[model samples]
Target chain A: MNKTGRPQDLPLSNPRADRVRDVAKLAGRPARLKRGHFLVEGPQAVREALKLHQERLAGGEPGVVTEVFASEACLDRYPEFEDLAEGTNARLATDEVLAAMADTVNPQGIIAVCRFVDVSLDTVLDAGPRLIAVLCQVRDPGNAGTVLRAADSAGADAVVLTASSVDIYNPKAVRSTAGSLFHLPVVLGADAAELAAACRARGIGILAADGYGSLNLDALQDENARRRLTGAGPASAFDLGAPTAWLFGNEAQGLSAGELDLADHRVAVPIYGAAESLNLGTAATVCLYASARSQQEPAHGETTHE
Target chain B: MNKTGRPQDLPLSNPRADRVRDVAKLAGRPARLKRGHFLVEGPQAVREALKLHQERLAGGEPGVVTEVFASEACLDRYPEFEDLAEGTNARLATDEVLAAMADTVNPQGIIAVCRFVDVSLDTVLDAGPRLIAVLCQVRDPGNAGTVLRAADSAGADAVVLTASSVDIYNPKAVRSTAGSLFHLPVVLGADAAELAAACRARGIGILAADGYGSLNLDALQDENARRRLTGAGPASAFDLGAPTAWLFGNEAQGLSAGELDLADHRVAVPIYGAAESLNLGTAATVCLYASARSQQEPAHGETTHE
Candidate 1:
């Protein structure tokens, strides 16, 4: 604002002008994503970023944020920005500049460049790992994001998007996740075969969802079958306490035959209506919830509480 | 192609153009919709309409289709038009004349007028009656469409969108459904309380998906709880075969407290990621699949027959 003939009093424009432009470009390009960084625009995502920053600061680590930008009006609207402004750099931009940098219409007037937190399979396994969703070749960013959101809300251990899936850092995907992207380890570009093998090695059951599958998920969760699927025997047998990975496929083709064959179990969502198939994201969500339900302990009995 | 100055071939400059203008106006006016009529333009939807008409014809019912409009090129592209033209009325319009009635960009050069199909709850319930998805106040047309598509793929009995939801007939919603709209019975404009009651009357356990709910879906599918929810005696205690309905709420507010209270059970998708919530459609898909899984029978031992 100082040099661009805009209001000089706005704090978000001058200091972060270059960074905002970089974020805008980064959002459209996938190669830049491998740098282990991404842009989070819109007010909701930006607010989540700031909240994460605050949490990190409170915990004694310097916030990992790269930059933040907003219109002068936004800062005034969020008065708590004063505390946020203390250790980190926050800049003001004119509404026009902010809009130009935003991916959404009616820009939320705030944006941030953030470093992707390093989340490894080891970290997720260390957590009380019960459920996880693995997206395979899901090309749509919105679908991928929505799946991540479901995984977050369902308290899955982690969400791993395979190499062929949409870029998790895509702004559309990030927006669709509704802030779940920040709360969990969203590992992208994992080798599917290796990841599947690793999950199996760790006692995780790979449940693949297919439209043509003979086994019904309902059958899997049946009392007798549940005993077999979760009964203790060999480490190779299905174990409910061990991590479970739900494999979802592309929207058009669904899971490849090879991928489906690799799973320990193939499950189908029964259809009594005329629909040809459920959308990939929806299918993934349903499968994840089903697996979660199948493994859940009886309500009246003593068990670990969520 | 017949007569240069004929009403069908002539542009709007013709003195008799009022009839054609009225036909085009019918597409936009709600009064026409209220009259149980709607227009389908472009070749895709029109082609689908024709297929639906053929299916009706095969079923020994007279098709209620009113008219078809096409340019000479369109008729020429599908020479069968000449035979189908015998019993049905076809107006040959010039490109400009056809453009006047077209609803999309780059018109597909074909249009059809047909009576709207009225589907009721009883018709859907009687179709197969296994799995169903009940949408409450989902405002996004795209989300609504995606849910319909998912329902079709998952083979749900029907999709019931509450009165507060977006219009199912919205063109955008129709397009988003990817032809599933025509294949499925999508009942819209039902009151939430009334719909819940109807589901209850049918012995369908209304499971509401909410993030803050204390019960995980895994717990709901447990043998004893499922038996209790379905009110099935101890013999089928774990048999969750009773009809079930999955309730998904608005994108922003999610299920209202009142709606959640009305549900037989409130279940949550556990989240482990940073994003806050799954999109409405994704949540619906997950919950529907969970229900489907819980009700399906296991396949392992059933294959031991001769």
Candidate 2:
């Protein structure tokens, strides 16, 4: 739709063709950064990317998705893909060409080139978010993506990935997100300290999800129970139902003392079994769901005294 | 430890050796079945395998661990591996040979050959399980492995993979378990319908985890709340603390209608966000944790009335 003057006219068949090689280069971080583009593979992610692009275009902004490549079989099965690309860019390629353009061993017949979609930390902060997930130095792509998906599923306003975290544009992470990446704002390269300060300034409580935290999650639940039952209410315990930002740390080292000190509360999801710990992704999901459940519950009136 | 009269005297340096090829072949299902053995890669899995094998050998049963291959560097770093393998078998392998025996890009310096660990359905059922995870037609090896890990972490008694599910011994699944394969009993290739019937006969409540079920998990928690608050309890609503087996389904199709009908109650985890649904592993974690939290709580007196 940008009309850069060159239009593809033929169905690409050669996997080693220059165009295919250039597109395939987007799989790596350096190339993606250099070209200012990333690859979106598979029908689900492509569909979501196109939909978001259309919304941006209608809002008078530059479209994020620049081009789509699909095989004839893929187009035949999902003709709506072609219709979606009418105002943008589209091309037909052979299965081998499409596979070459993809990162997976078995690509499901479609790929898209899109501009980087990360928003600034200020933009995320200025929105006055009610729920957000902050990943500090998360290294695994799948874990990062799953946490993003869990945050999205919990209806978080955004996800902030600190500078040391794995690149969100990593193909494996994108694949693991299962389209949730396009569903919400994912802020990258944020400074953890600055983000914490920003949340504090916004009157948003920060809860650090740490394995060794002194505060047990079930005890919090029990506190909520006693508060509700005895009418000794909210002030007696930290209220998860309030607007909050959850800070999760590196999968291996978890939060440092400095990082833990930055939060309003440090909470641990109780481990009832013998296994050493919950996987990062699973732990984050349980935490997010706890917040979601708590926030959805009807608010109990707070007592003036603690 | 079997003392088959063939003691390995020299370090194995050839990656193309026939013994190495036989070990590598265990990565495939056919070879695993025919040889009645599978490859357990990396130091963590190898450690667990050797420990379990030692336990079996002590109990006068056939050892599960057949052979352990480790680089001298690895054995030097962790002398425990050499000690653990003393009763069984241990061999020095060159880095190249170790890498060839491994399924991962980096095998972390060790690999072990172990017998299949699946127990009979009757064995699992006969134990009068307090908690169990039933996987019905779960096809993704990663998801299956993750669910197994979560089940183990929650202190579930065992994990049963139905007949149509992915092979639990698949190298990818084994890797995803992260050494949890040896943590608890994992029953494979079970019939879902028959398992449900047996669970019923044993007085274990079958709670089918369905995305579209009318009974919301939050509502179940609310019922628990009322039971706790009023003390007029137990018989009116399902008690998660009681003996229960959770039934989960495939990654894509979920549970079929017939599968849903087989359970005593169908439950859904409440989705608070716009994201479609929780992935299989995350959903199972939340469900298992809920039961774990309930069961771990001090028991409440049951009402005699139905």
The candidate that achieves the highest TM-score relative to the unseen native structure: 2
Off by over 4 Å in 2: A1-17, A229-237, A256-258, A299-306, B1-10, B58-61, B230-237, B299-306
RMSD of each predicted structure = 7.2, 4.7
**Tens-digit lDDT string for candidate 1 (A1-306):** 122312235354443567557656766766355566677776777777777788888999767567777776676676555555445566667677777676776557677778776477667656656687888899999888888877776667789888878888888888887777777776777777877888877877787888887765544445333344334222323443346888888877888887887788777866645665666667667666655544544333333121
Clashing pairs in 2: B1-B88
Per-candidate interface DockQ score:
0.42, 0.44
Candidate number achieving the greatest DockQ relative to the actual structure: 2
- Evaluate model 2 with DockQ and give the value: 0.44
Of the true contacts between chains A and B, what fraction does model 1 have? Answer: 0.78
Residue B160, model 2: Cα distance from true site in angstroms? 0.3
